[model samples]
Target: MISSTAIAAPEIQHWQTKNGMDVYFVPAAELPMIDIRLTFAGGSAYDGDTPGLAKLTNAMMSQGADGMSADDISRSFEDVGAQFGQGSLRDMAFMSLRSLSAKEYLDPALDSFTKVLWKPDFPETDFKRLKKQTLIGLKAQLARPGSIATKAFYKAMYGDHPYAQPSSGTEESVTALSIPQLKKFYQKTFVAANGLIAMTGDIDKAKAKSLAERISSGLKKGEAAPKIPAVKRLEKSQRIVIPFPSKQAHVFIGSPGIERGHPDYFALYLANHPLGGAGLSSRLSKEVRDARGFVYSIYSYFSPMASAGPYIIGLQTRGSQVEEAVKVSIEEINKYLKSGPTDKELNESKKNITGGFPLRIASNSDIVQYLAVIGFYDMPLDYLDTFTSKIEAIDKPTLLDAYKRHVKPENFITVIVGGEQG
Candidate 1:
């Protein structure tokens, strides 16, 4: 049952700039601060022939812009207590700014942010320094077993697909990245037509519009990026094991699941709570950790991305227990597919999800984040408002059907790294 007083979802105001950048906005008079997130089409998948160019480009942009040194830009924001952040992922690259609503802070912060975003200088001295840092970071990651497993897992799942590459480019790929290549990538990817902005806090629609317009005008009014191809499901199960010296083996199992707008998204989401997403109470945790005690911890989830992302069950187990852990996880999943969640489990999951829904949009910053996802994915504005109702509407049969339709236990592809499997 839902709470007596339902949590009110924030009102979202959306519009298109003159140059075509989509903007999502919400006003909160209580906070004297604002958060602005700008998302672009420049993700790791757009790296083209160079694997890490998109991420490198994003990092370099933050270091300097419009002839200003990184220190100049940072110090300007610091003087006003503004915060800046930027990163790249598989499907999108983003930068965010937080500042006081007072014009004293807002104007200067926005100025630095907009320039860094659109007119990135990618200063040669800093570029070489940052590239060195990236290469060093990549080497450190390679020395870890978990990183090895994650890369191998994607490669095994996606084969030669663009999505196969991790967001952090491989060392060889990063070394090959050049200033010219990144500049060309920036021109096509960070365009008004492929951009989205999400903002929340003390800004009015008029002010939001003006800010959106100023930033959008800087981007070239290029075309939207092409759609990513759908992922093909694995026909049969395949397990790839890599030997490492660690005593614990990292095992990741499962197959291609749903994409962002899948018909069964809500149902699949609710069902996963019992299967894996609900922490210690999850089925994987219960069967693999509590009942048998073969694993350090076990969990699972469906990553719904632009393409059909993975439905993964991840666990780390003692070297000798790797086989047992994988066997039990598969067994639990097949059982779930056959019978779905029990009536009791379904009810509990609904109550738990709906109860915790309010926290998702509790703050201006949280609303800005949800706004970003909603805008980037072209979701309905009423998404947060209707989220709880949607989860509560699912029944046992519906939940079971959605899980069955998306998960393929029989065709699971498992990746095991570290230790020798017994």
Candidate 2:
């Protein structure tokens, strides 16, 4: 068990701007740097008719804004010695900045960064180039067995749900994407009301507050996005095999897992740790890889999103050995399910997880990332402080029961890419 004094969560200060923008802050003056991340609603989940519109729109943000071209936008940050970043996912679109705390640099860095969120131009030239690049990426991804397997897995698991498509979208959908569509999606999603701000390192409350408000005010005022439609649970097990030219096969087995903050989340987390998430210490690695020599690597994880995300067990092996690898993997799952982790496994995992707690929040960027998740999901402020204790409290029966309820083979969606040629 972690002593209370062994770990302490940084003090988190949270408040909302008048316009409904959220701010989560932790002041860390030890470093001369500050990391700021801004997240908003409607990631790929809101792709609606177009599969990759949300991602494309996110990319277009840093290209140009307010008569500033991509080169100019990038150069501005470069000149100030600050780094700019942006990314999109199934649940949110975000922009991030890392800069020195000096007022001279922080002011202009924040200025340019703030402007890109609201004043994007989505220039025609960059749009064509970016779309062409996106299309090229799609072609490259389709050529790989691993990518094909993942794409098929999501499509099979979700089946026309908003989460069905990859964040990058398909080639056909991306080709047809237009600038007007991006503008509309941007206006609807990137509003002040939908935003959350997370800040860490080298700043006082006044500066954080002012920066949050300035960032919020730059965006158009609009309502928060509606809850994404629920994912439809699969009624039965299904397998999809797409034979590719590769000598190795990639296999993905999973079902819808828990959402963020599920009541039994910690139990499942510990359960998966020994089952597959603990690297060499995992059952999959020890039995399937070490003892049987069936797979190159095998691991499982629950990607808990705003909705129930995937609980995936992924592995790769020689095409001819695909059946054996999968059979062993499932056999291990059933055995583990029937009998939970041994007392030894549970205690070791707890130590392995709790031991690393300090390192997880050791840096400003790390905390900033956690802050983004906590703020976006409306999680408890003490979430970081309490994470290890929660893990410690979970026992074997609880972990096993949670796994049984959550991972049902009846609803498994398995996709295998590449196999022995028929």
Candidate 3:
């Protein structure tokens, strides 16, 4: 077990660029590498009438940009031995870069990165190919038990909310997207003021500041995107079973949970460990998989986004065992909600969480991502420093209160694919 004193938080410097972008910097000379992440409010929730527009727009960023073809962009980074990545989640879209801290490799890489961000070409041929590929992928997913359960589960829980839409989009939706729509969405959402930059490595404060400015200066000076609507409370329980030819059943149980920056988040985060978040030792895994041999795996987790996200318990079992598996899983959840975790369970959880904290920020890439999350969510700057202490302070009573406040077993929307129909 790791001790608290063995883990020390990196000193994070926070500031704003002249273009109104937020910046978080951690100056670490321990390595000759630097990692940068720029996050924008351009996720699927902002897709509006075009469901997969955000994801498509983000994916196209590196395909071609400015006057460079996709091959040109790839060769530029590969020649410098730098890495680039772009992705979108429910609440944010992000571009990341890892390069040698020396100006030679770093300068050229930043130029290409900013070009991709500020002036994506969205070549018609590439767009057509990507859209065809996405539609084919969506078609394949429709036949997958896990995919079907996931899509159905979100729809059941969110009920017409933007969160219900798939991040990759459905067949009809992706096919409907056009070059003009993609460009329009990109222009509106990928703006300077709508984003934050996080950087970590050998760079000093002066260089970091300049890097941040150079990254955002090319972005359109647009305002932040509108907030996602709050998730409504579940008025009734739903048990949806989708039939598939597969022999194994996929199960998803969840409802809307707390958002990032909620006061109760820490308590619930600790409380969830023993229930399903602790891997094989968790109650759900033990009860549903170990004790009964009903499933290959089972777990629970919260996907906390800018708005309230889903708190989910998921598992897969034999098609014939679906009913029994759901019954046992729900029973375990209800028991935990009723009595909470014991002192021994809570102590072990706290030890595991606190002891494991150092590994979460052990490298520049990890630090960059955490800084992105902190800045994007407006979390306390000292969040890492105080994380372990907060977990240690969460006693049984506090854990119970948080569980009671956030989780309601009766409201769970359960979706099972490849299960027997009534």
Candidate 4:
């Protein structure tokens, strides 16, 4: 058992380079390995008429770079036993590396990153192979009920908003993407002005600054990233049912939740834990899984984003038991909406969150990612410091009011794939 006592947030060093690149360094001498990440505001949201540009560009960053062959790039990282990878979500793409802090290992890794980011040699042969693989992966996703349900759910919830589009992109859109489109999108979005460089490990402030500058030097200052258009509110209740031959129905029910800066965020976070946010201890799991044994798992969560993110409750159950599972999920939601959480539930929830907070930032790579998010979202420097206290302050009545305001069962946009509407 862990104590609910507050843990101090780690102090971070911040600096800006000559080319307007914001850099954040958190020096953790505990480990001999250094973690570095470069994040740009290039994501699926930037996928224009040509979809998957952001993703494909990110994936191919190291396939060939600075006239280096794909084999050479992979071998260089393996030589030092370092890890290099890239990932993208709806809002940003990140290229990250973990390597030994020894000067011998460090310089080569930095040079490799510089080459990968500044001058990718997207060979024609590899591009075709990568694109075809992506297309095949997309087709596989279309065949799965879980994939179909999530795709349909997003479209229904976000409507015409760019957020409605799948991150991996549609079959038609990705199949048509040209090399020029990817280059144009990369040049536009990967500018220094639209990104942050974060480094953590056994290093002093000066070396970290130099490494950040060196890696980002090739990037010229450019315009801010293109903004995602506003998401129109989902007005009517929507139900999308797609038939598949799977034995279990994948059900996703949700509505739009809070934005990154909403004041109600802390309250919502606390309220959700007991409702369905906590894994085994969550209400949805207990009611739908433990009590009646209707399904294997039932869970709910809210993703707070730059704009209103979706509040989602998802479950998978036997096709014959789908209606029963949905009914139990609704019952739990309605009960929470009317009564909120009890004082005991609220106390335990806060206890678990505050206790588990430190583990969340225990690693250098973890801290780098957290710092990147803080810089990207414009969240306060002391956001982590104030986290526990904020959760501690929410009383029962306050949470009850929040539940009444936010969780509306009637407004839920329910989507079920591979199940019949009974």
Candidate 5:
């Protein structure tokens, strides 16, 4: 049962910019600050033959723009006490700004933000420095067991798909990247039509609309990116083991899961919590770490991207205990696939999930991020309002059905790094 004090979902205001960008706004007058996010359909998925181009392009955004050096851009926002953030994921690249709602601060912050989007200089000095830093980081990651396991797991699961490529491109790919390629990718991907804007906090509808227009106007008008192709399910199970000298082995198990808008998403989401997502109380944690003392940590999660993302169960165990840990995990998963959760487990999970839902949107910054996701993925406008109700409605049979249909234990691909087999 939900609490009486559960916060009601805020009303979202939606509109479209003249150049075809979708915008979602929420007015929260309680705070004197505003948070804004601009999302574009230009993540690593659009890298085409240039694997790390998207991440590199995003990294270059604030380095230099509108004839200002990176320091100048930094100073511009610092003067107004605004915060700037930019990053790329598998399916989207996003830029965020948090500033005081007053026009004195908001105006200058917006000017700097728009200039970065429209006039990135991609200065030669910054590019060389960043590229060198990326290579060093990649080299460090390559030596880590967890990183090796993650890359191999994705490669084994996705095969030749774009999802197989690491969001941060390989050392070879990063080294091969040039300024011309980065500029071309920026021109094609960062456009008005491919954008979504979300804002929350002290702003009126008129001001929100104006802000959206100002941001979108700086982008070139171009067509939306092509849809990512559907992922083909694996027909057979495979295990890949890489040799490393670590005392513990990193293990990753499972296969490609559902897409963002899949009908079974919520059902599977609720079901996964008890399995491995609930930290120390999770089934995987209890069985693998607590009961058997195999490792310090173990967890599972589904990364539902625009295309079918991975459903991964990850853990680390002493090299000597690797086989037993894998055996127990598989047995537990198979049992779950056949028999579903108990009534008590289902009810407990439901209450836990519902009770915590309010925390997700408790802050204006959090709300802005959620709004950006809704606009970018075309999720229902009432998504937040209906979230708790939907989770509460899930029953054991519905959850079991969704799990059986989406997660196939028979076709699992396992990756282990740092053990005898590895």
Candidate 6:
């Protein structure tokens, strides 16, 4: 029952610079525009006791660099109608730019990107201002019930691991971080050897290669990244109930799931779609929202990362119904683990997953992202092309086996926020 939909993507060009910089490009001549993305291996995962190091480094890159004031930098980009932005996840930091194809503007935009990457000054004045703003944001998030619940969940699951550190550092941690610590972090991490550039838009092979070289010319190829130790596995189930004054009770139930490189990713991914990946049609939503009406919305997902990621099921409901909703959800999980999906459900899930896969790589920009990911994770060249076929081929028994091996409810962690009674 899987759709034989053919998924096509623009061919990706991959290469590496002499300085160990990986490069990926996808050409689209029609749009007089290009988007460039650079990613480095160290992110929040690299933050030592001085949490927020990676994020702070990324934020300060644009604040001032190469003797340019933050305002001057902003005005330079605004004059050309271009944008430069930065982001970080647990594993990598990303800096990207989008600009008009005109060389007069594009060259300067690229120059600004280079300046941030290679010559950021990390001005103490700007650092103080950004730190204050970051702390305020952190305090605001701590006031929310969902934030408290998630923080508690990570603490329970990851304990003192680097994974326990929130992407946005705690208020106390941010307030304690100084400009000197940020400088050392920048030197220790962000290096050419750990970085790559991904570009998409109007450019030929020669021009693209030259553009990459010009931007990365001054980068110092640094040492290999320090190895990140593997995440420790939890041996037993843990539960925490928190009471708060609120209209609804928020619940989260989860356990460690597959990593990005796990061989079972394809099977588990396909299996998850029918269970909760689909919106209204997914079993969790259908049972919890439509049939029983105990909750307004319910969702479940596994975020595959460098290490085992949290497999989570979350819901919000009337305070009095929290225990009932939790009971029903556990029952559903037990059933799914033991019996797996029916043939009809499996087929529909495959069809939806396969049919929708093409949208994931619909354009040059999309191809660039995929390329960057594949490069970062060292995935095979055929990953995008073979994705649909792989999903279509997953049978019921295989997925069931993976689920049984991975989803052990007894080892899961449950956190409840704003529920007076559990």
- Tens digits of per-residue lDDT, candidate 5, 1-422, equal 65823668988889989988888999999989999999999999888877889999999989999899999999999999999999999899999999999999999999999999999999999999999998998999988999999999999999989888988999989999999999998998889888888999898999999998998987878989998889999999999989998888999999999988788889999999888888898888888899999876899999898899999999888888998899899888888888877777788788788888898889998999999988887889998988888888888889999999888878999998996543
Model 6, position 306, has a per-residue lDDT of: 73
TM-score of each: 0.97, 0.98, 0.98, 0.96, 0.97, 0.95
- Candidate 1 wrong stretches, greater than 4 Å: 1-5, 420-422
Question: Once all C-alphas are superposed, what RMSD does model 5 give against the true structure?
Answer: 1.5
- lDDT tens digits by residue: candidate 4, 100-210: 999899888778878888998888888888889999999999888888998899889887776788988878887888778777777888789999988889999988888
Q: Give the range of the ten consecutive residues with the poorest summed lDDT in model 5.
A: 1-10
lDDT of each: 0.88, 0.91, 0.90, 0.84, 0.90, 0.83
Q: How many angstroms is residue 332 displaced in model 2 relative to the true structure, after the best TM-score fit?
A: 0.4
**lDDT score, residue 390, model 5?**
86
Cα lDDT tens digits, model 3, 283-368, are: 88888999999998999998898889999999988988888989999898889988998888888899888888888899999999
State the lDDT of candidate 2 residue by residue for 1-422, as single tens digits: 75643678898999988788889999999989999999999799999989899999999999999889999999999999999999999999999999999999999998899779879999999999999999999999978988899989989998888888899998889999999999999999999788799999898999998888988887777989998777777789999889798888899999999889899888999999999999987999999999998899999999998888999999988888889999899999999989988999999999888888888899999999999999998888989988988999987888899999998876789899986651
The clash count of every prediction, one per candidate, is 0, 0, 0, 0, 1, 0
In angstroms, the error of model 6 at 415 is 0.7
Candidate 1 global TM-score: 0.97
Candidate 2 Cα RMSD (Å): 1.4
Lowest lDDT block of 10, candidate 4: 1-10
Compute the lDDT of residue 123 as modeled in candidate 2.
94
lDDT (tens digit, per residue) of candidate 1 on 255-297: 8888887779999999999989999998889888999999998
Superposition error at 321 for model 3 (Å): 1.0
After the best TM-score superposition of candidate 4, give how far the Cα of residue 153 lies from its true spot, in angstroms.
0.8
Candidate 5 TM-score versus the reference: 0.97
Off by over 4 Å in 6: 1-5, 420-422
